[model samples]
Target chain A: MELLGYLGEGFATSLMPINILIVMIGVTAGLFIGAMPGLGSVNGVAIVLPITFIVPPSSAIILLCAIYYGAMYGGAISSILLGIPGASTAVATTFDGRPMAQQGKAGLALIAAAAASFVGGTISVVLFTLFAVPLADVALAFGPAEEFALVLLAFTTFVGLGGDDVLKTIIMICLGLVLSAVGLDLISGDPRLIFFDQPGFYSGISFLVLAIGIYGVGEILYTIETQKSAPQVTPAKITFRELWYGLKEINKLWKTMSFGSFLGFFVGMLPAAGATPAALMSYGIAKLLSKKPETFGKGAIEGVAAPETANNAASTGSLLPMLTLGIPGSPTTALLLGGMVMWGLVPGPMLFIEQPDFVWGLISSLYTANLFAVLVNLALIPLFVWALRMPFTVLCSLVFVLCLVGGFAPSQKLHDVWLIVGFGVVGYVLRKADYPMAPLVLALVLGPLMERSFRQTLIAEQGNMMAFVERPISGTFMAIAALFFVLPMLKHVKRLLRRDLSPAE
Target chain B: MITGARGKLRACLGGKVETIMLTADRVLAAGIMVLSVYFMWHASALPIGWNGMTGGPGGGAFPFWLSGIMFLCAGGIVLRSFKDSAPFAKDDTPFFDPDTLRSVVVVTLALTATVAALPFAGAYIAIPMFLLWYLKIYGKHGWVLTGALTICTPVFLFFFFEVTLKILLPKGWTEPWFFPLYARFF
Candidate 1:
């Protein structure tokens, strides 16, 4: 009854005229951004974040979440039509989506993707609502020791579970931490790491600068190399008959959709595994269980449904930790966390206590955003087919201009813009060398918190290093972190043992 | 027999042949090593050790230690690259194709030029110049399209950033021209 009361209040806040309008605009913008071949949710959010200051903080957050939801839905559009995954999250959608499009069922494939996304989003949002309160209640007990341990666990998860090269990951994490430490030392109030006595070093690097550089400028540069030739956009015209038929087909796959939603929700909460892996895993499992598994990747409707559902579910799942525990579950959520911090609505257990109205409003907005995203996606298929035909260079040019303006808009500093260029070029080169950018961005965002908590704990304990392990909550976190840190090494050892046994056999 | 053994050794190791990827990998690792040392040197400005008064690690301790770890990790990457079993050694691909590299280089240079001119020439002039170069000259789109975008983008940016958000973009020399618009809006 209490939950219901809170939810009713949330609906009252979200259904306001202005908030609904914001959601509609945000979803439309996100759809176009996500339908582009080289852009994704992170890029759309980073570029649009600076401009969102026109609205109040709570409304701005709602708008950003709407964009995130819409982008997840729009990612499947290009995957089915152009046979190009609009974002990394939608890569699995291309496997069967392209085949279905090739078989002249583009309309059916698109309708299925939209319906599946709606189901996935609806299921996950309900889970998010159920879990948010309990998670915050648990996190309310966290002291500085637990905070430090949790951040450590977040970093180790990337090293242990990420598919990127381990050495590169470590280097990026360290680099980000060092960069985060450049400005005023939180403890002593003294300036440090002032390189060449530049005045900009005094304020330190913003996560926004790094995000816009890597995801915006670096991404454009990287795309210019890979997307040299234009892709054919499969024309999709949706009729009511096809939509109804598609819904009926999707209705039959309730088991696959439900399983995918559950899998995605759980996996997405982990910092290491998010939408990409969840969608791939869901698709693989769906195929494995299907009676006619051979049809997968060859135009099976189930193939399209499985990944579309999972990716959308995973996106919502990634938001759970960010809002409740002040730890981002993915790179996009990290940016959202940064944005929230900038707005002075610092996301944590305290946020729920201090600002229940804001929390509920944002949560309920997610439900509305999901509905609008599906509606907008289904309605805008013809528009996307036309817009996707716009030359890549036009998109590249506009994005570059936005990067320049957006980078300057935040700090109004030429120095930051220069840093954006430098990071963009460096980030592009590093990406070419197969270095993962996600850990680097996450580390920068979390670096100050990790340092602050660690020092705070020590100060309270009078230099007792064992205080961290003495607290059960923090000790458990540290132990899990240790396990994650050693997981890759254990796998390596097992591989060596197998190699040795195989030689003898 | 010696040549054959050498050939087999080369094959076992990624190879003696130098590819762009191999060169890039070694260079990047070396660059990171240099960066780490530089960070450590700066970090030592403060106490990169336990401060008894504070009952904890000093401010510099985190960056100093983290940079040291970064140095070690980068060293490991460099060392691994030299080993015969290094991942990049066996399969060699060029870092960037020639045609694509040229295009990317051109775009990057144009972008850099636009940014450099932002504070000096101001955003209005610098941004439109970038659009014209990108759409008209590089993209070879029709003049109507280029002209329309070039004219329309700044107008939108002005209303959105300057008028609505009240966040003024750097006008540089063109600061005088915006006075009239600001007067009306303000």
Candidate 2:
């Protein structure tokens, strides 16, 4: 009941004319960015974050969240029309989406994707509302030890479950953490990692610089290489008749959508796996459990619905930990987290208590954003189709210009701009070598927190190394962290055993 | 172990040459190792050990230990690349095909040059020039499209950033040209 009361007040705030307008603008912009072949939510958020300085902090956050939702919905558009994923989260959507487009069912697939996304967004927002308070309550009991353990658990999940090479992932994590430590030491206030003894080292490295570099400039460079030729957009026309039929068809997949929503929410809460893997898993499971499994990847509607629901759900779900626990579940949310910190808002449990209006307003805006995303997405399909025809060069050059300017906007430093370019080139090379960029960005966002908590615990416990394990809650978290850290080794050993057994067989 | 595995792979492929990707894997790993050493050295500026009185590790300990781990892991990557069963060990594809390499290198150089010029030539001048180069030279876009964007982007950026947000972007020598606009707007 109290939660409902808070939610009502949140709606009061979110329904303000300014907030609604912001949401509309954000969703529309996000749709275009997400509809573009090479950009995704992370890139959109990173590039646009500095520009949000014009708005109030709460409205800015709402705008970014709206963009996140719109991007999730928009990602499917490209997947269906361009036969290429607009974002990595839409990769699974492309399995059936492209085939459907080819079969001249692009209109129906788009409707199904939009509807499924709405369902996912609605259900996940409900779940988020229910879970956020409870999670924050639990988190409120945590001390420095628990915080360290949780952060450790977050990192170990990447090592264990991340699809990238474990060594490369570890290297990236270390690199990001070290870079985060480049400024003054948290406790001693001593200058550190000041490469070339430059003065720019004093302010430390901003996560925005790294994110814009990697996702913005680096992505363009990577895309320029890969997208050598333009792709043909499959023309789609949605009559009202097709829209109604598509909605009816999606209504039949309620069970699959619900299942996807639940699975996506849970999986997305894990820092190592966000919307991309959640969508993939949902698609895989939907296929396995389908009445006509073979129909999947052959223009089946369920194939499109399942992943669409999951990815949208996952984006919302990822926001839970970031708001409640201060650990971002995805790179996009990591950027949001960074942006929030810059705006002088502290995340984690205290935020909910201190800024109920902001938290609940953001939550309620998700519901509105979802509605607007689907409506605007359907209404503007023709616009997207036309926009998709624009040359990639124009988009790339604009993004490049934005990156250079956006990089300098926050810090007003040519040094930061230079750093963005350097990071862009290095990040692209590292990515080519299979280094996972998500963990690197996440680490930079969480590094200060991790270090602060870790040293705090040690100092509080008077150097008692066992203090982390002795506390019951922190102990449990540490146990989980240990298991995650060893999970890859376990997989390796299992593989070797299987190979040996195969020889005998 | 390295030579033996390579010999087997070579024999299997009948002497198919390893591509630059393989060399890149080793080089990247080696580069990371060197970077880790450098990080460790820099991190030692602060106390890189535990402080008994404070009951916590020194400020440098975290970065120092993390760098040490990075070094070890990078070494492991190099070592693993030599193993017959390692993923990249069996791959024969080039890290970057010639076409990709050329485009990537050109764009990177252009981006770097633009950033270098930003403080000196100012955002308005440097950004438009970069956009022009990207669209006209590298992308080979038509003059109409390139010219429009190159002109319009600076105007939008100026009004949005300078007038609306009051975040003054660098104008360098072009600072005087913006003085009249600033007088009008600000």
Task: Report lDDT per candidate.
Answer: 0.92, 0.92
* Candidate 2: regions farther than 4 A off: B1-16
B29-100 per-residue lDDT for model 2 (tens digits): 999999999999999988888876565999899999999999999999887766666667667777886767
Q: What is the TM-score of chain B in candidate 2?
A: 0.89
Question: How much is the lDDT of residue A317 in candidate 1?
Answer: 96
Candidate 2 scores a C-alpha RMSD against the true structure in Å of 1.7
**In model 1, what is the error at residue B156, expressed in angstroms?**
0.9
Q: What is the TM-score of each candidate against the true structure?
A: 0.97, 0.98
Candidate 2 lDDT over A223-279, as tens digits, reads 988887899999998999999999999999999999999998889899999999999
Best by DockQ: 2
User: If you assessed candidate 1 against the hidden native complex, which CAPRI class would it receive?
Assistant: medium
Candidate 2's docking class is high
Local accuracy of candidate 1 as per-residue lDDT tens digits, A1-505: 7877888899999999999999999999988988899788989998888889999999999999999988898899999999999999999999999999999999999999999999999999999999999999999999999999999999999989987888999999898889889899998889999999999989999999999999999999999999879999999999899999999999999999999999999889998889999999999999999999999989999999999889999999999999999999999999999999999999999999999999999999999999999999999899999999999989999998889889888888988998898899999999999999999989999999999999999999988999999999999999999998888899989998989889664
